[model samples]
Target: MPRTALIVIDMLNTYTHEDAEALVPSVHEALPGIAALLKLARASESPVVYVNDNFGEWRSHHGEILRAALQGRHPDLVEPVAPDENALFVVKARHSIFFETPLAYLLGQLGAERLVLCGQVTEQCVLYSALDAHIRHFDVVVAADAVAHIDAQLAEAALRMMSRNMSAAICSADGITFDARRAD
Candidate 1:
């Protein structure tokens, strides 16, 4: 059986970037789904990994980042999907979670052969992360409703690329099942 992991990417953002305002609505819509998936991931004994952007804070830790984001422009986005004590946290400097991070090693340690990706900027970070996961030979299952984007059109295109080129399974968050007995 394939071991599955949930990767929540870049949702701890401050939303202070140039394109942040435009993406707020979509991010708001995705919050509930992300939260629900987080609950499901925890209940099933599956690993819940948060791959967050460090935002150039060399000295920043996960708790510091979470606190900052909670006090940042949009706390609603960060607060709902905040990482818990049991969730594994990996800070990344770039778009891909595997870039400059120990994500691959952590996944290896957890024996995660399949990944359920959920988070912000569907056209950018989420897309790149999915590609990297695919290249690493991991089965990718993107929680479509749990991902937000800056541009709707580009986000759609990115989803298509993930489905066509990378063979990622795109489905709603509620449809995602982490049951260990079933084949992913």
Candidate 2:
């Protein structure tokens, strides 16, 4: 086995905020499971990648994003939680994280052969990332409970497609355990 990473996409509370313009129910419920995966990644020392969109705006850097999300008034459109020092943030302009981001290079440097993708909008970014990882010959695991979509039916269907069509392992967050020694 090779190195693995825990990818949490768009878990920002901004998307889940009670007054978010784009709030989705599936993502809201995904928080607990996302939290569980976050805990696991932190506990296991596995690298955590946050694939967040620039909200098609901001026109800012990562630091500015943090500032706006955490301190900007006017109900900023971002989750107000600070990421850990080791956690890496990738701001994506398109729906796909791998489209033009450093994600490929980061994963290569991390020696990550398996990417555990869990986050919001099962049919969009999360789906794109998972499929990209699989096509790239990376082991892709999609945590069912840790991800959500506005349409539960589509989310469920997407999971099936990922598992049966793309060879993704759809497991629960609690069932996942990262082995650092295995990375060696």
Candidate 3:
């Protein structure tokens, strides 16, 4: 059986701020799908990984990113969460979560063969992660309804590119089903 995981990338207070948030309600529409996936992951005891951008928080640290997220300048945009202590997080300084983060090692450790990737900025971080994960040989499933972009037009283009460039299975969030876990 292949172990599966749900990865929610970005969706931070920095990217999603109130002004920008108001401008792009499509991002907000993604919330229910993400929440449902998170709930299913929790119920199934599957790992829920948060691959968030550090956004030049270099001078501080990952902890600082968390603090800034919970109570900071961009809380409305970022929408930081009190992540369950059990969940894994990779605070990324670069666009892709796999870079400079222990995501690959951790995913290998968890024996994750199938990954459900979701998050903000379809053209950048989310796109990079999906492609990179496919490169690393994980069966990638991208929830189309779970990704958002500040530019709807660009977001649509990104989706088309992802659907073509990567071996990512595109499915509506409501249609996802967690198959029984497979042994690695």
Candidate 4:
């Protein structure tokens, strides 16, 4: 049986960017769902991969990156869905998690055929990552309520594109089932 991996994208944020003002509220709304998904993934012993932006801090590793985000203005946003010790961490410099990253190789090594995606910037990182995941032939599932966005309209359009163009499963976080024995 193929394993299901939970991909948490760009959730480790500092909230110091120019668009942070517009993005924070959306993150607030999406937090509970993201948190719930994390809990479920962890409980099920499924692979939990956190693909986060490096924020131009090229010198930082995963722990340093996480530390910086936690020390940022909105630590509240980073706390709930923070990566646990067992979670896999991938630092990305661009929007798509797979771009110039070892995520594809890592996923293949873990035997993750189905990916449950959740996290911030729904129209940007999440959207692009979904497309990349689609082309890679991984079964993509986007937790609608678990993704945050900078623009509501663009986010909705992105979700539509993922569903229509990429054939990604768009559903609530609660709608997801994590059993590796059951095909999604």
Error of 3 at 113 (Å): 1.0
> Residue-wise lDDT of candidate 4 within 1-184, one digit each (tens)?
4588999998899999999999999999999999999888888888999999888989999999999999998999999988999999999999999999999999998888999999989999999999999999999999999999999999999999999999999999999978543333
Q: For model 2, what is the C-alpha lDDT against the true structure?
A: 0.74
Q: Which residue pairs show backbone clashes in model 4? A: none
Candidate 4, residue 91: how far the Cα is off, in Å: 0.5
The alpha-carbon lDDT assigned to residue 116 of candidate 3 equals: 91
Question: What lDDT tens digits, residue by residue, belong to model 3 across residues 37-90?
Answer: 777777777888888777666675556666776675445434433356677777
lDDT of 2 by residue, 63-151 (tens): 66665555533233235224677889888877677888898899898888888998777887778888888888899998898887866
> Which of the two candidates, 1 or 2, achieves a greater lDDT against the reference?
1
lDDT of 1 by residue, 1-184 (tens): 4888999999998988899999999999889889999999999879999998878899999999898899899997888889888989999998999987999999998888999999988999999999999999999999889999999999999999999999999999989989553333
- Model 4 gets an lDDT of 0.93
Please give the lDDT score at residue 134 for candidate 2: 85
- In model 1, what are the clashing residue pairs, if there are any? none
- Deviation in Å, model 4, residue 148 alpha carbon: 0.3
Q: Is candidate 2 or candidate 4 better by lDDT?
A: 4
lDDT of 2 at 6: 90
Name the better of 3 and 4 by lDDT: 4
Q: What C-alpha lDDT values do all the predictions have?
A: 0.91, 0.74, 0.74, 0.93
